[model samples]
Every structure is written in structure tokens, then in C-alpha cells.
Target: MDISLVAGLLALGAAVGFAAGMLGIGGGMLLVPFMTMLFTAKHFPQEHIVHMAIATSLATIMFTSISSVRAHHARRAVLWRVVKLLAPGILIGSWVGPWIGAQLNSSTLALAFAVFVAFSGTQMLLDKKPAAARELPPAPGMFAAGGVIGVLAGLVGAGGGFVSVPFMTWCNVKIHNAVATSAALGFPIALAGTLSNIYFGMKVPDLPASSLGFIYLPALLVISLASVSTAPLGARTAHSLPVKTLKKVFALLLYSLASYMLYKAFG
Candidate 1:
């Protein structure tokens, strides 16, 4: 790889990592846009740019999620019962979502992704308090939410936190616990999305040399390592910060990114 490309990857990794740490968000929302920009700038085929960005982002998030989950688990904040209830649906949905995404045109996929982000951001901004429930919902409810969240995560290459956290909180899970548990769910999202992307991209031709299906291995490695290294720092910071304030700020950032993504899709 060129030195400039390597440097750019490192910088991208660091930025994504910092955002992940600070916001309890899967960095895909940030990483995907930046990766798409980079790919376009490199003169990569327009049709392939979104595929590469989403796949590479998902590939890297596998590491970021692990790092965040470890930190959350150490605090005994993850609700394994919820995870267990949601796992089956999440697993199936994640695989299916990417396949559906791959069939769409690049611009359509980007628009769908942008709209989801905007809606998620708006929800986060408006939510003022934890929902009335204080415990995990019954298995059926959990399963339904998991399926929806998984599909959304797969489509957008996210950690599922954007949807999962709020859903958990609405089910009466505490905010911190919701965040931590949502962090743990990232693993399944990443795994299913990565596998689907690989399967979906198998027949596409003229990809860059380092690609495995849609994933670019070099970018994945650099970003994963850097993001993992910083995730713990972000987790620690989460404990000290006023979470509601942080959520608003993060929501604003997401809205801005979502607008930019919408422009890219339409322009």
C-alpha cells in the first residue's frame, strides 16, 4: 500500500475510534461516509463505493464492538438475558438485511442509510428520559425488536446501538445498562453483516486487489486495531459524562452526517 494511503487509514481509524469511545455508538455511521468519500476520491468505480464502504466498516466494527463489550461486561452492565432473547432474530435478520441491500442501486442504498440515520438521530435528540419499564421485556418483544434492529444494522453496517439502546431503554432497561448491552450486541451485527457482504459481493468483478468480496483487508486491519485501542478510553469517559447531554451532541453530529450522506446520494 502507498504510504499516503496507510497514513490516511490510520487517521481515519483514530477518528472513528474516538467517536466510538465517546458516544457508545458503533463507528459505522462515521466510518461509512468517510470511506465512501475516500473511495470516490481514489476514482474507484462509482457502483462499488458504497459496497466497499459498508463492508469495510462492518469488518472493522467487529473489533470495535469486542473492545467496547469487554469494557461494559467488566462493569456487569450487559444484560445477557436480553442478548439471549434477541440473538436468534438478530442472527437471521443481519444475514438477510445485507443481501437485500446488495440488490439495490448504490444511490438507493445510500439514501436508505441516510434516512435511517436521520430518524435515529432525531429519536435520540427527542428522548428525554428512560422509558417507564425498568426490566427486560418478555422474550417475544425482545425478539421482535432484535429482528428490526439487526436488519437496520446490517443495511447500514452499524453496531445496532443506535436502535438497540433506545429500544432497550424503552423496555425499561436502565440507560447505562442499555448502552452497555447494546454494545455487546454489536458482535452479532458485525458477524452477520460481514458474512452477507462477502456472499453478496462474490460475483462482482474488478474489485481492488486487497478486497475479500466487499471488504478491503488492509483498511479493515488498520481501522480495527486503532478503534479497539481507543474503545476502552471511550467507555471510561462514558461513565463520567452526563449521558443525556452527550446523547444530544452525538445526535446533532449524526444529523449533520446524515444530511451530507443524503446530498451525496442525490447529487
Candidate 2:
């Protein structure tokens, strides 16, 4: 790998890790567009750029999530019982998402990602709190919600925090706890999605060197290492910072990246 590319990946990983920690996100929304840009610059196979970006992003979350969640757990913020209830369905949905993604062309996949990310960003910007009377549903409801979130996360290469945090908040979960729990949820989503991407991508031809199916191994290694180191810092900041303000800033970032991805898809 070029020294400059490694440096670029390192910078991206640091930004993503901090955002993931502070926002209770998997950082995929940030990772996918930038990774797409990098892969395009490298002149990777045009048909495979989005797919590879998604795969690599998911793989990095597997590391970042672990680091972020550990910090949240130390603060006693993670809702482990909730995680247990939702995980089974999340596993199933995440496993299926990559197979569905494999059927779409690169442009279509990029379009899908852009649309979903833009929606998520809008939701964050609005910051509407759920009604006070609402509460978390029964286990079955949680499982179904997890399924939907997992599938979407898998498709878009996100950590599912965009959807999960909102859903939990709507169910009256506190913002801090919701964020922490969402961080915890990233593990299962990333684990299942990454494996599935690899499986589905195995059939594609002409992947770049050092690729594992759809995953660009070099990006995965560098990003994961750098991200893990900073995730704890982000998690700490989340407890002290003005998170709502930070989220608004993040929302703008999301909108810009999503727009860039939309241009990539159609341009």
C-alpha cells in the first residue's frame, strides 16, 4: 500500500471512531462514502466499488464497536438484556442483507445507501423526542425491530445505530442509554454482515488484490486498528459533551456524504 493511502485511511479511522463513540453509531454512514471515494481514486473495479466499501466498513465496525461498547459498559450504560432480546433477529437479518445486496448493481446499491443515510440524517437533525408515555415493547416487538434495523444496516454498511437509536428513543429509552446500547448492538450487526458480504462477494470476478471477497483487506486492517484506539476517547466524550449539538453537526456531515454518494451513483 502507498504510504499516503495508509495515512489517509488512518485519518479516516480516527474521525470515524470518534463519531462512532460520541454518536452511538457504527460509523458506517461516515465510512462508506469516504471509502467509496478512496476506492474510486485507486481505480478499483467500477462495478465493485460500493460493494467493497460497504464490506470494508462493516468489518471495521467489528473492531470499533468492541472498543466503544467497553467504554459504555464501564459507565453502566449498555442495556444487555435489550441486546439479548434483539440479537437473534439481528443475526438473521444481517445474514440475509448481503445476499440481497449482491443482486443489485453497484449504482443501485449506492443509491440505496444514499437514500437511507439521508433519511437518517434528517431524523437526527429533527431531534424529535418520543412521547412520554411510550415504553419499550415486549421481546417479540424488539426482535422484529432488530430484524429491520439489521437488514438496513447490512445493506447500507452502517452499524444500525441510525435506526436503533431512534427506535429505542421512541420507546422512551434515554438518549445516553440508547446510544450506549446501540454501540453494543454494532457487534452483532458487523459480525453477521461482514461474514455475509464475504460469502456473497465470492462469486464476483476481478476483485482488487488483498481483497477478501468484497472486503478490501488493507483498509480493514488499518482502519480497525486506528479506530479502536480512539473509540474509547469518543465514548468518554459522549458523557461530557453536548451530544445533541454534536448530533446536529453529525447530521450535516451525513447529508453531505449522502449527497456525494448520490452523485457517485448517477454521475
Candidate 3:
């Protein structure tokens, strides 16, 4: 691997890990589009670029989420009951989502990613509290909600925090608990999605060297190295900062990313 690529991956990992810790996001949303650009610059096959990006992003999440979640769990913020309720459906939905995504062309997938990210950014920026802060719904409703979060996470290479954290908070869970629980949820989402992408992309053409299915080993290695060390720092920072301010900044960043992805997709 080139030194430049190594540097890029390290930088990306540092940024993503910090975001994951601070925002309770799995960081795949940032990882995906950025990796797409890197892969494109490397002259990876256009058809497989986005798929590789998504797969690699998910793979990285598996590690980063663990680090972030451990830090959050140390703070006693994770809601174990909620994580248990979400796991089954998150796994199923994440597994299925990649199969569906693999059927679409890269440009279409990019467009879809842009749309969802833009929407998520808008939601975070608005930061509207629900009319009523109520308890979580019944088992079935919670499970179904997990399914939705998983599907979107798989499709967009997120950790499901963008959806799940907000959902839990709206259900009257404390924001810290919601963020911590979302970090816990990222494990299943990343695992299921990563495995699905590996299987789905096995027959894909022209994947770059050092690639296992869609996960690029060099990038994964460097990124994981940087991210794992930084994640706990971010989790520590999260507890110290005003999350409202963090969310606003993160929301603006997401909007910028969404716009750039759209430009890349159409330009």
C-alpha cells in the first residue's frame, strides 16, 4: 500500500472514531463516502467502489463500536435491556439489507445514501423533542423499530445511532443512555452487514488487492489502529461537552458530506 493511502486511512479513522464516541454514531456514514473517494482515486472498479466502501466501513464499525461501547458501558450509560430487544431484528435486517443493496448500481446507491444522509442531517439540526416523552413501546414495536434501524444502517453503512439514538430519546430514554445503547447496537448491525457484504461481493469483479470480499485489509488495519486508540478519548469528551452543540456541529458536517457524495455521484 502507498504511504499516502495509509495516511488517508489513518486520518479517516481518527476522525470517524472521534465522531463515533462523541455522537454515539458508528461512524460508517463518514467512512463510506470518504473511502469511496479513496477507492476511486486508487482506480478501483467503479462498479465495486461503493460496495467496497460500505463493506469496509461496516467492518471498521465492528471494532470502533466495541471500543466506544466499552467506554460508554464503563460510564454505566448503556441500557442492556434495550440492546437485547433490538439485536434479533437488527441482525436480520442488516443481513438482508446488503443483499438488496448489492442489486442496485453504484450511482443509485450513492444517490440513496445522499438522500438518507441529508435527511438525517436535517433531523439532527432541528433537534426537536417529541410532544410527549413516553416509555418504550411493546416488544413487537421495539423489535420492528430495530428492523428499520438495521436496514437503514446496512444500506448506508451507519451504526444505526443516527436513527436509534433519536428513536430511544424520543421514547423518553435519556440521551446518554440512548447514545450508549446505540453504540451497543452497532455490533450486530456491523457484524450482520459485514458478513452479508462479504458473501454478496465474493463473485464481484476487479476488487483491489488485499481485499477480503469488500473489506480492504490495509485500510481496515490502519484505520482500526488509529480509531481504537481514539474512541475512548471521544467517549470521555462526550461526557464533558454539551451534546446539543456537538449535534449541531455534527449535523452540519453530515450535510456537507451528503452534498459532496451527491456531487461525486452525479458529477
Choose the strongest candidate by lDDT: 2
TM-scores of all candidate predictions against the true structure? 0.95, 0.97, 0.96
Tens-place lDDT per residue, model 3, 37-132, is 999998989888888898889889999999999999999999999999989889999998888889988888888888988887788788877667
Top model number, TM-score: 2
What residue runs in model 3 are displaced by over 4 Å at the alpha carbon? none
Of 1 and 2, the candidate ranking higher by TM-score: 2
Q: What is the lDDT of residue 224 in candidate 2?
A: 93
Top-down lDDT ranking: 2, 3, 1
Residue-wise lDDT of candidate 2 within 69-140, one digit each (tens)?
999999999999999998988998888888888889899999999898788889878988778889988989
How does candidate 1 fare on TM-score? 0.95
> Where is model 2 more than 4 Å wrong at Cα?
none
Q: Which residue pairs in candidate 3 collide? A: none
| Candidate 2, pairs of clashing residues | none
Q: Model 3 misses residue 176 by how many Å?
A: 1.9
Model 1 C-alpha lDDT per residue in residues 1-267, reported as the tens digit of each score: 777777888888887776766665678888889888888888888998888898899888888988887887888878888888988788888888888888888899899889998988887888756545466667887788789988998988887877887677666666678777877788888899999999888878988888998898888998887888888887777767786876786689789889878988999
Cα-based RMSD of the predictions, in order?
1.6, 1.2, 1.2
RMSD of 3: 1.2
